[model samples]
Target chain A: MTIRILTEGELRSCVDIDREAMETVASGFRGLGEGRAVLPPILRLDVEDANGEMDVKTAYVPGLDSFALKVSTGFFDNHKLGLPSLSGMMTLISAHTGRVEAVLLDNGYLTDVRTALAGAIAADTLARRDAKVAGIFGTGLQARLQLRALALVRPIERALIWGRDPEKAAACAQEMAASLGIPVEACAEGSAVCAEADILVTTTPARSPILQAEWLRPGQHVTAMGSDAEGKNEVDPQALARAERLVVDRVSQCARLGELHYALEAGLVEETQAVELGDILVGKAEGRCSDEEITFCDLTGTGVQDTAIALFAHCRAQARGLGAAIEA
Target chain B: MTIRILTEGELRSCVDIDREAMETVASGFRGLGEGRAVLPPILRLDVEDANGEMDVKTAYVPGLDSFALKVSTGFFDNHKLGLPSLSGMMTLISAHTGRVEAVLLDNGYLTDVRTALAGAIAADTLARRDAKVAGIFGTGLQARLQLRALALVRPIERALIWGRDPEKAAACAQEMAASLGIPVEACAEGSAVCAEADILVTTTPARSPILQAEWLRPGQHVTAMGSDAEGKNEVDPQALARAERLVVDRVSQCARLGELHYALEAGLVEETQAVELGDILVGKAEGRCSDEEITFCDLTGTGVQDTAIALFAHCRAQARGLGAAIEA
Candidate 1:
């Protein structure tokens, strides 16, 4: 019994997830919403030590016959030790046989990619067809991935970047302009960027409201990707309350971990008020009702996304014959 | 961020799982019974395809700062395909950071060893110290491990083996006699071996009773390591009713996936009737009461054992400079 083990580099060489893979994952979202599969509860562990804090989360999605177990650690104090605050590895296992097929040592790269891809999927289904302007808050890895994914899914003419660090925001704009082939400019304030864009993406790890309800324009699609943990909020509760359509990757997950957590806590929304992203993907619910309707997609990430990406990677790796073979 | 990948051969060379490491794991069991640690639920998947039937069970133990995810598949139909079905890997992750620290491609060998060691721990705490005769049922990998573990924890002077295959049982007896320097014989029937032994170990995959109540004697301790899944049983429920005391690895797990599962279902024993094996190890409960008590220890494997062995393997691999290093 030999199980093929694919390492980080090997996986990178073999996996070519372009627009096609993103579409497949989007389809999986629909399957998930229809109850054709099972996405179990996410398992979490919080570790506190002299080196700071780290949260480990594992998600299991049964339908894809695969589960992606990711270990992400945030060592806030690691900067002093000349190490990044975050590091991780994702193991893709066969749900059918429980054989670990690949070890993705991408730190947090895949998380960023899958998360942004989910946002892109939401944009594809919910954003206005001619969505021209994109607003991005926070000049982080997530911000970059969101921009790249949005480019793949929408016709973005320009991007507005806003961050706490003016220099970093400027650098992000310049980098995106060169790498993503888009015209991007750093805004003076978060609200300035939020008000001018047709699509908005919040990637800040903020505890307080950064984007207010008044700043959001009608028909503008907003993706709240940050504020996934408890006590974390990027968008104000008023924004969620005012949105005409409240869509989420997973209702239960969003209620606990996404921006919806705050909305529910503030009595602004209930479970019945929310529609799953999958429902809209499958045309079970309306995405953007009118040109002037406010819309929001709260994505906390799901195990199904992990499973889809893993399956995609596995198939691609096998096709390319990239991984090393080991006898079991 | 670099992660180490340990192959089976490399891991075997690095892991110094002699008596000392086993003793440490034995000591950790005390904390398990005290409720200071948690062994989460095991996830199982059953696949019956052209390749035969495969049962994959993953056990998660959070206290060891790790989880043991093991996969075992039965390839009874693999003869036609010229393949073996019962093969899989165990992944050990660091609970603190959720980093997959090591992957053991042991094909269930480690699980067998850890399970047997756990049985040894139970026998050490529960079995009479001066027991001279040991009886084992089913000639398999688990049976060998159980006998080896029993010898490690008791003063066993001889071993009696029983299996459906007379040739396999005779071979097992000869192997044990040569390796352990103990008097060994293959019994014609299960009752014959059970009646003559001071300590009994059953490691079969039978769905019906293999051991009878009438065969058990006073001052005898029986360790049933089989009957881990739903419809698997080896010892009679009446035997459990006759036992003076019953010990289990985990109360909840035993009630769901061990010999206790049947006993509880039969209404012969309740959850409270069973004591954790860890409790006995920590002296929280009595083991044997005089020389006339019939004791039973239901041995369903736990995730803690996986974590212990994985950690042991990781440390040893690091020390010996084994396994390939890949960038995370």
Candidate 2:
């Protein structure tokens, strides 16, 4: 039997700022919403070694005929040893023949990109079209990707950055301002940024609500990108109560792993209240109703995204002759 | 993050075929029957590009901390491309953080071994105490592995081989006899050797029943190793009726993908009539009620086996310093 092997360098060279990935994922989401494909299943592995903590997850999406299985080890304790906190690889297998088509040593780079792209697509559908200002909380890699992806979908002329680390937030603002060709300022307080921005993006790994409910303005849109796992929250529960519209990637997954978990637990939102993002993408449901209505999109990330990104990466690599081929 | 990369050669050196892999997997079956660990989930990939074929598979057991997601791709048309009909890779990921630890390019060798080990373990429990004669069907790699694994668990004095191709069967008998230090003869008729054998193993890829109900004798133990997917059957459905006891790896999976599928579909047996192989291994169910009763152990293979074998391989490789370490 012969199998095709695509290495990490090849995969890296093949992937870029993948608009194709975003579009493909969006289409996959639409398919999921339309009940055209099966999302294989989610498998979780909890790792407890001498190295702090981490969780490995594999999500199967059948339509792509591929599975994007990610293994990310959290060695937060490794930082004291001068090592990175997380490291992992994503393996893309041919859904048809079960041959591993690609091995990506991305160090979570592709995951970050896909996640950010989802946020961008969500913002494109849920955010007010004429919104001008964007407020981004958290100056992490996710925060950067979210900002860049938001800019791709919205005409954000200015961005307000806030983080626990003021120096890091200032640096993040400067970098975003220079790279995006937009005005960006470091905020002294989270409430100030929340009040000024028309679109608010929360990217922090906070266990409690960081944004206040009273600060939210009508007609504004919010993208909650963090709080994916259990026991994680970043938005005020009241924020969900105030929103006129709520969108999620997967209703069940969002209710369990996304921001909806807390809202549902607190009885702030009912099970039938939230709509899937794909519903909005395919026009099965309303996204933004009026300029004065507040909207929120919660993303927990799905296997469909992984499958889409992998397919896009494979095609892009093949077209550019980016990957090395190995005989099986 | 650093990931370990083990090539075929390195993996081979790291694994202890006799004691580590086979024995550990056997023990895993026992553990599974006792409900000690969770086996990885089974995933199917349907190949539409090449031809209409599906790879049905399950990840193995004993991989609580590190799971080797087993994927097998069936390309029945690969012969036209000068390739084998099946190809796939086993991806091992850290259980702690979900970082992919290694990819073993075994080309289904590991799968064959683990499956054969299951058969061997079954034979250890159900076969006659003084078994002397062995009959094997099929001249494929699985046939070879089954014979080898049987030798590890039994003291066979003579062997008989039968296949669709007389020449292949004769060659298989000759090679196995020389290597195993046992007398082996190629039988002209399929059931000629079955009448006198103490243990019979069927390893064919036949889509219809190849073994008849009358071919078996009293005190004979049958290990049906083929019939792993839907629409594939190697033993006669009536043969299951003859067995006093029928054991399977997993009742649910076996009913769907093993010889039990045919029997159940034919209304020859029901879920209540079949027993799991793990049950026998853990002594929860009886293997052979009496020496004179015919017994059949259907081997459908499970994800628990994959996890067990992969974990054993990884540990062995680490101990022997077999795999190369790559930067993540």
Candidate 3:
């Protein structure tokens, strides 16, 4: 058996924020929600002494020929050593023989792409058809990708970016405007952007809430994808309580560790009110019943998405002959 | 960053059952037992439809320069398709930058070696110094490996082999006798072998207890390395209850999933009675205070062992220039 190796640059050249990838991620969620996928709870290790942590996420979706096991690490203090904070690779294994078939050393670029695609999936399923103005918080890699992803699902032509560091936010707007072919503005205040946004995305790792309930509008849709780990909250608990429809990427995870943990802890929202994003795609639950309905999605990321994107990347890499295969 | 790829053949040539590798595994356990290692709980995914399962194991020993994430899969029904029952690989990553360092496509060879070394560690610590007659149950790879490992710790001169298949037992005895330079006897009954043996090792996947408490003799040290998952037992619960000293690879794990679970479930053993194997290695606890004491150790396997073995293989491969490093 031989294993394919795709480098970060190779994966970036083959994988992009596109419609097919978004649909593939959507189907992955549907597989989980429809009871055809086996997703184990994430295994996380915290190396507090080194100010680092690692998470292993995996899932087996029956119809897929392969499954992926992704090991992602976050060394928060790596920046001091001139290293990236996030680094990871995915190992794709054949379902039949359980042998590894490919290793994607994307350094977390594929993770960012799949995560952004999941945001597109949520928006395509819940956001209003004519949603044009997007308000994005946190001007990081995810912030840039999410805006581009939102454009694929909604008619988002302009975006207002906000960050704790105003200079970074302004730089993000200028780069996104040039790359995405849209007018991007930097907002001095987060609330100012939230007030005019047809769709809102909160992508900050904050101990306290960054987006409040009062900033929400009737036709606005919100995608909160930042508060994945415990004790991290991006959207206020009251925002979920006041939303007409509250959805989560995975109910099993969000209820315990994601943003919903705080919402459930504060007794602002009942667990039953949070429908799964997969259920909406699989026609098991209603999504965006009316354009006036305020829809919110809490995405903590899921194993199924990793498997979907990894398999997709492998297929694309093989077709383009973009990776090297070493026979073992 | 690039990852070094070591095939199964390459890793096999580089890694072996030796004093240095065994010592490395011992230090890993010591790190865990001394609270200097971050070992995460195993993440297991069960694919009932495909009759397959996968486990993700990893650990961080602060003293080690790198950590490993091992993805092992067990597809029992794969034999029908002419494939092995278990397949796996270990990915070694940098502890400082969390970058990919090497991938050992060992095909479960390293896992078996580390597991066998753990058996040796248990025997070296808890077994009597004069243990010369080893009684082994099972005719699989682990049975052969454990016997070789036992020779490293004790002055074994002979082995009594017992198996469900008598033909396999006879074959095992013949092969072991020729290779190990020891007299090996094939016993028709398990009781017969257990009666005269100084050291006993159970390496089968039997669901129910195979080694009876009545067969255990004084001064005998038994290592149960089979029962890793819930509801799997190799030694009878009564045997553990009757032992003078009981040690577990990991108390938190063995208490819930290892052979100790059955002993605890039978209400014959207290959780506190099961000391960690590393505790004895680190001199924090006594191991076999008397030659007459019957000691038992449960080896469910842990992430620390995987990390240690992976690092050992990576370093050996690098020194020998046995692997190919592809720049990412």
The most accurate candidate by DockQ is 3
lDDT of 2 by residue, B156-185 (tens): 888989998999999999999998898999
Q: Order the candidate numbers by TM-score, best to worst.
A: 3, 1, 2
Give one digit per residue, the lDDT tens place, for model 3 in A85-133: 9999999988877888998988888899999999999989999999999
Choose 1 or 3, whichever is better by DockQ.
3
Q: Write the per-residue lDDT of candidate 1 for residues B1-328, one digit (tens) a residue.
A: 4556677677656553257667756755776766565555654433333332333333333345555444454545545656544655566655555455666776655666677888788777778878889999999877887888888878889999999899999999999899889899999999899878989999999999989888998889999998887889999998888999899988888888889988888999888989988887777888888788888999777766766776777777788887766544
lDDT of 2 at B217: 94
User: If scored against the real structure, what TM-score would every candidate get?
Assistant: 0.85, 0.80, 0.99
lDDT of each: 0.76, 0.77, 0.92
Question: What would you estimate as the lDDT of candidate 3?
Answer: 0.92
Top candidate by TM-score = 3
Model 3 docking category = medium
Pairwise lDDT winner, candidates 1 and 2: 2
Model 2: DockQ vs. true structure: 0.24
DockQ of model 1, rounded to 2 decimals? 0.23
Rank order (by lDDT, best first):
3, 2, 1
